[model samples]
Target: MTKRSFDQFFKNPRHWREDLVAVGGDFSVDRLLYAYTHGIFPWSEDPIRWYCLDPRAIFDIHRVHFSKTVLRKVRQKKFRISFNEAFPIVMQACSYREKDNTWITPGFIDGYLELHKKGWAHSVEVWNAENVLVGGVYGVAIGKFFAGESMFSFESDAGKIGLFHLFAKLKESNFELFDTQQLNHVTWQLGAYEIPKLSYLDRLERAIKDMVPWVIPLSHD
Candidate 1:
């Protein structure tokens, strides 16, 4: 495989078959840099395929839909949410235990840890009444854009709660965009839609120009 510059990313051919078929494959720094900067991400395991779909789904902070059911649950105060309190454990749980497959390999973890230390990554964690972690989500923040990675839940509705909390907090703090990468039934139900890949990159470019601090002081109770 040939390496390419960030500017040459869109021109490079995407051959998933060869690019990520090997076990324990690591995305080169340049490749990963290109991926995120271009609104694409590696989301598969085994033969990890790089994905960049047009009409990508994202949640505009002002437009994030919060279901009344979820809001009612949040008001009930049954669970607690915390931010940046348990980064590694939350990420590991999101990968290893809840998801039968994982692309967040050791290398990915270490790389993201470096990102976290650089203040480009963050975590939002949820815990049950017993103060046991039940769900969480993690992602990288580039300027005002947050590229969501993955979330996992160990209890009923925990993941949704975590997402709701994160959404509300981010919106309240005036973030411009929350990139979900890809959308599924749950995300679609909770209000996620797609935009063209090129359009998505344009949005990312604009979003990443704002140096607003991702200042979401999540409540920990």
Candidate 2:
């Protein structure tokens, strides 16, 4: 779809009030980037539903908080932290971790795998001392904006550790936005908050205009 048509489709007033704004589109790299850059995202498959939440949730990068315990665990370095080392594995783990309901279907995985190849998608992986994959967080980055897709953990505090590292990197790299889509318990505890959709769209517009490199080392020492 052309950029003009895609923008026109989302300009409908109905998209402003509703969470599920539009439906039926492929999760192509261009489509995904367009959606995220415009504050919209794909939530489900089987025809593929697109959504833009009314009260969008995001982390104010510098304000993200980690409890003393999590901070200490991070300091202990019991788990290894790495960026983009296990994109597909992390995405698949998030999909199956919630067996009853998962929006990360095969199509979604395929789409993001392609995005990763193009350097627009990334994953922060947490591995135990035994080198076993225990937790991870994955997301898409466009310019200075990052939209966190999902996270999963096999061990206690593992996911939070990965998340902490991601936030650190975003702040270090001077990112402007860290969109979390919606508020869940984990995000709430970590200081994710909501803003009006229009306000989020405004921020997103300016954020994607500037270039901010994702410059973290592939492996954390």
Task: Choose the strongest candidate by lDDT.
Answer: 2
Clashes of 2: 0
Instruction: List the pairs of residues colliding in candidate 2.
Output: none
lDDT of 1 by residue, 1-221 (tens): 34443434443323322322223334554455556665667765445466666557887766667678878888998987888889888788877754366778776777677667667778988998899999998987766788888888888778788888877777666677789877898888878888766677778888878644366664544
- The digit string of per-residue lDDT tens for model 2 on 1-221 reads 89987876664423467787678878888788778877888888997888888888999999988999999999998998989999999999999844497889999999999989988999999999999999999999888899999999899889899999998888777888999999999899999999998889889889889644355644345
The ten-residue window of minimal lDDT in model 1 covers 13-22
Q: What pairs collide in candidate 1?
A: 55-194, 55-195, 55-196, 56-194, 56-195, 57-193
Regions of candidate 1 where Cα sits further than 4 Å from its true position: 1-4, 8-34, 44-49, 97-99, 211-213, 218-221
Best by TM-score: 2
Native-referenced Cα lDDT, model 1: 0.72
Q: What number of clashing residue pairs does each candidate have, in the order they appear?
A: 6, 0
